[model samples]
Target chain A: MQMSPGSRKTLLRQVPTVVWVLLGMILFFARFAPAFFTLKNAVNLLTQGSILMILCMGVIVVKITGGIELSVGAVMTLAGMVMAWALAYAKLPIPVALLLSLIVGGLCGLLNGFFVTKMDIPSFIATLGTQGIAAGISLGMNNGNVIWGLPASIGYLGNGTFLHLPVPMWLSVLAFLCSFTLLNFTPFGVYVYALGGNEQALVLTGKPAWWYKTLVYVYAGLMAGLAAIVITGRNMCAQPTVGLGMEFEAFSAVVLGGSFAAGRGTAIGTVIGVLFILILRNGLNVMGIPTYIQLAIIGPVLIGAIVLSVLVEGGAQK
Target chain B: MTLKSFLLRFSRLLALVLLSMVVAVLNPNFLKISNLINIVRQASPQIIISAGMTIVLLTGGIDLSIGSVVTLASIIAGYVLTQTKLHWSIAIVSALGSGLLCGLVSGILVAKVKLPSAIATYGMLWVGRGLAFAIMGAFPYFGFPNAFRYIGRGILLGIPVPIWIMVAVALVVYLFLKYTTLGKSIYAVGANPYAAKASGLRVDRILIYTYMLSGLLAALGGIILTARLNAVDQDIGAPFLLPAIASPVMGGTSMTGGRGGIGGTIIGTLIMTVLVNAMNLLRISSLWQQFAIGLVVVLAVWLDMWIKKKTA
Candidate 1:
């Protein structure tokens, strides 16, 4: 099992540059920001980052199929709004309300899939349309106001401790497992990669590529729905705009994870990617940097890291 | 134009007419001349922005940063106009110049660095928005000189200046796409990049120019928006991104590139403007506006696809 020096070098090169950037960031933040490395802060970061982690799990599924899932943020918002409405107005039990949110999210995903596969619209545009629809419905449902009066019991799902870990952390891990298993251990997973890498081959094999493509969007929608439950439970209310711009963050995390092109990404890679973003943002927060300034820095860092990976690792070349 | 091309071009017009009829029936006030002018004026900046989007779309790319570019360019202009002692005209130059620069960077990212359009432009969106936020920093800029305001507010030949600007922009873009070698190359490149490159057309250069044009036009739209509002803030341009994208696609411009034009975009803009106007006049909750627009975008694009299929 001894590897040659050249082969080892190539193996090392296959590692995305984000790993190093992530290490550097950790060291830099730990030295400069005294509060960055605390156990408490780590818990807080995981709690906050769980929603992003969940969303990224969904986004990577679609990205691997060469489709962008822009509607997840809005879909999550709509799902939360529905759940909140069911809780506050309909007086439904917590479980029913939660199930409703997932259904709503899946329905939105179905619409996106229909637009993309059946209507032949580009994924971004189709998803953008769904974003508008979902966002609009969320806003219109509550007249652009926050919905309050959720059952106290629901908050336990979002904020309560589970085996000394935050509930959100557990839920996010569960989501990661779902995405990981679905992407790695199933015939569907292979078809998903083939959909992006070589659709003609998939079609030639008598596989229904369009159906798998549609399922990718649907999977993303389900994740958004799950995120909605956590966010709603945590806040104890649903704000129509709570999920705003979340899709962009999820997309960035997936791309940052080394899914630079279709058919090239891993669940492990996405976890690192999520951690990279979570750490950067959390570190900046610990350092007391203004939100606006942090935004300016993150943009350059994101693009630079991706470019470095592409150039240095020669990863994901067409 | 052949009857087929004529129908292809004016199908959106028919939709616009039918939509106006519905709105006019529901609210007769919507049909008033003043209100109609108001709609177009309000839509002017959108039309300009969508024109830029249409050009980029024609070249088989998307520019998500146009909204951010709008915010940054106008803020730059506002900073120049209010904070500096420079002539008011300098504000215009600064706005357009900054916009062009943002587009150039995006172009290099997409055309040369070979990043995906969605990712490159999405990054630019953040940078532009962040820069705008940094520059403004918890305070908005206002109180531009009257000369600057005139572009948005003043009347020209019984019409608002914004309307005139919109028309002029449409005409110039229409002509450019029709006659200019570079403009034609944009279509060629979008239709098939490999073929375009093999045929000695500089696909990369065309992509850069298309993005640059989109940026410049977005800045121009921002200038008008700033003039009308008489102020500038970081959030001013955020909402325009969706409609800017929806309009050209609704106008029958293919999202996949190489088959739509400014002519279709203008009609699409009118349809959206009228829809919004109808909603406002009908006293529907403004919250539903986003939903309606989103529905229209999906339906419009769906309709476009259906028509394309039928024709093919």
Candidate 2:
């Protein structure tokens, strides 16, 4: 697995500017805030960030197909609601409830795919519609109340640690690996890139571009489903609004991970992007910055990072 | 307009009327004059916001920041009117100014920096919301001066002031889009940006201007909403975002841009407003409203696309 020195140097040169930003941020936070550079904080940050990390993995797949998946957050919430309902009301076993959550998430994704492929709706609007539907169902499931009283075993999925790592972290890493393998090691990955880069060309190649595109959405939904289980297990309850606004954070993460445009992201790059946001958020929190100010800062920082990446990329081309 | 085009155009209005008939039949009170005025008044700010959204959509760009722009603008105005000794006009100017500034930045990101419109504006959404939250903090602003509240609450000649403002906005937007070179340029840019640039149109400027207009209108809508509620909170503008996009698309304004107008947006707004009214009258759970609105948005766009495909 060892890389030759020359190949390693070229690989280093190809890294995005955001990596530098991330490194600089780490140094800045470590120096300015003594509390931020600890092992405990690092674990805490990743644990807190695991759900978003998982969601971004799914979103990146859809992004590769030149589609923005806005429904993931709501889909996650809906899935959690379904899971909670199964556990508390339907008296289902923990495994059955978890499976039901994944099923719900996949169904929502299928709905989004149907809208985009069959109806020719734009991804954002189609997903926005799905967002409403999912959020609505989540709200309506228990008359907008939070579901509680899960069996004790359910907590292990969210709170337990495995091999000296948090359970959610394990799940997130699993998601990351799955996404990476699916995109890089399979023929489907080629079609996904083609779907984003030149959909018509892919269609003309005698491939079923429509089905692949639909599968991309369904894949995203399944990830949301996975994230939902973690989030629900973490809280031991499912509020209808639990996944509110996570989609934007995941989208931002994917974009910041060097996918400036569609058809151009990698799992390693996505990991970097997730770390960048995690550090920004964790650093700001460690500094005792107000939540509102942190929000104000994140937006400009996101835009600035992308702009910097674009400039660097352009400069490299020249 | 030719007979076919005329029928195609009026058919939306016909559908609105038929929907009203159905609602009226269910509730019987839906046909009352007072109830009708209430619906128009309730729909006023939405129509204004959607009118702005129609302009952006006409340019083949979407502004995800308008909802936040609405919140930011109203919070600015509320702060000005509630905390300062400034005239209400000054407050209005500042609100509009804040929106314009936001739109300008979003436009620069999309046009000059070459970012996607959705991403650029979506970033602005958080920036705007964060600023609003930072300014307002935990306290909601309430109890505006009568002079300012008059815009939202006043009834002139037996019609609510918002309805009047809505009409004014729609009329001005309609005339501007139909008659002005810049308006035509917006359409040209949306239809085909490369062609527009080759034809010597200032595509970037038109985009910036369209976004600016949208921001301004969103501010105005926010102002009316604030005045009506006499309160400004952090999430006040969030609910309006989806409907603003939906109304225009539902009104026969194409999502692809360059093919819709303010007239259709008004009808679209009416249809949407009536649907909500029907839901309320029917006692459908308030919890299901978001689902219904979301479904309507999807169905509207699907129908629009279907009709276009068949026509093509």
Candidate 3:
């Protein structure tokens, strides 16, 4: 029997939930198939997923504006390097170093925003250019050397526990709460969705859509900076290669979470998406699969997720 | 040509000349013919790839998978040569065939599957790179026949054979773009897909062809790169991808589509090659080279936008 359009729409909407269920199955199997399933492993998964989740949050914001930020990974690297320089070489306090890194990231984002809005460049090309610049700066900062000997206090954010969970995991939760509220409760958030939905219409309505669009990029940059801080804390060192290929990870998470290509996403969906990927990787590691095999899986899975989402969303519309 | 068109055509040329003068001043050896030939030789792979990329950009699409395609193509050729008794010519054909296959897949994804070009191609990038790694098992392939090396590193009457191949490819593409009905249709499609469709142009067909051409060219570049390096590795074309994209954009090809040509791309390639050569001559750290390239890309786009504004 042919399904009605209404039924098809409802069925398609369950696709993401089905994906989550599949992930749950994997988690359950991972528990039984190997000795890798324990409270400690779960905490490790959460902690590792936290920084990536934060990065995915920023990516979601920009993607919601119908733009992509390819430079976030590089910006994260740059921010880490800058923070490391401030803390290790300049002898700055941890708080000041962290603040400076965030500012640097924000400025990088602002430049990306300016290029997209004022300069009328495509987001992909602009960010691609900036990615090179940020990577270069990261390498040039310490001549590609890893900066070690960060103050012990800096480790608190990355290694500390709060309420029996990692501090970074808690921070990710806070970040998600803030993002959800900002997206749902604020006028600016509405503008962001509208901006992605029909930018020309907003422009015709006499609204400065460019400002909001640019702000989205700025926010993404700031989040990258925060992610850098967390990563540096966790590793206790800052290296030029930190955050390599992270943009792809975040992009995959955002897409897998049902964020439309033309912009539309949710913090909760992204959390599930990030957790799904983290669990998959963690499981692969436990199973002793080579890293290249993991890459092979990720590439197809990302493409499949995007294709499925497009198909389902299109069906819903019809 | 009108003054406006003249400026559009020669802006990159002017930049190239200006850059050449600065490099010459920095080091007198830069003006020597041998050094100049060396620059063109180094730029051959980029030039070949950028020709196809220009066409893709002109159609308002992108092919981010070219880098991975190059690696894969090289690996395929390398595997055939090393593992099979196939002649080098057969290996070359297979390498080119692999690239064409990749391009065809990407074309179908973008045109038939109705996926965004960027998203589809980006996905292909990962798949292709993964396949390259899988095939080679993280090892580099060497020991190719000397005849195979001739395509990339042979000298023909005191000039590199790759430079000759690059010039020929550029000539063919220039002619195709200038004198063919399909070429004009590509421009029409890039200018306005809806209008092109309404006017009886096969928009999807043209898009597919463009991406296929991009893939083919990327494969050709892969072959050349493998020959030049005399080895095949997983990272064969990783560095060329950015420069391939950047060259066409720097050449004043509108990323939004329908406004560029092969001539501008040549100048862009020259400028980039010369710039890198100058950096090496100056003993500048390679870390800063990426920064310089990024700065140049942004500035070039910014300048292009300014010119468009002034003309408007």
Return the top candidate by TM-score.
Answer: 1
What's the lDDT of the predicted structure labeled candidate 2?
0.89
| Winner by DockQ | 1
Candidate 3 regions with alpha-carbon error over 4 angstroms: A1-38, A315-318, B1-5
Displacement of the residue B146 alpha carbon in candidate 3, Å? 0.9
List the TM-score for candidate 3's chain B.
0.97
Note the DockQ of each predicted structure.
0.63, 0.54, 0.56
**Candidate 1 structure quality by residue, lDDT tens digits, A103-176:** 99899988988889999888877999899899999998878999999889999989999899999999999999
Binned by DockQ into CAPRI classes (incorrect, acceptable, medium, high), candidate 3 is: medium
Task: State which candidate, 2 or 3, has the greater DockQ.
Answer: 3
Per-prediction TM-score: 0.97, 0.95, 0.94
C-alpha root-mean-square deviation, each candidate:
2.0, 2.7, 2.7
What local lDDT does model 2 show for residue A265?
79
Q: List pairs with backbone clashes in candidate 2.
A: none
Write the number of the candidate with greater TM-score, choosing between 2 and 3.
2
What RMSD value applies to candidate 3? 2.7
* TM-score of the B chain in each candidate versus the native B chain: 0.97, 0.96, 0.97
True-structure lDDT of candidate 1? 0.90
**Alpha-carbon deviation at B283 in model 2, angstroms:** 1.4
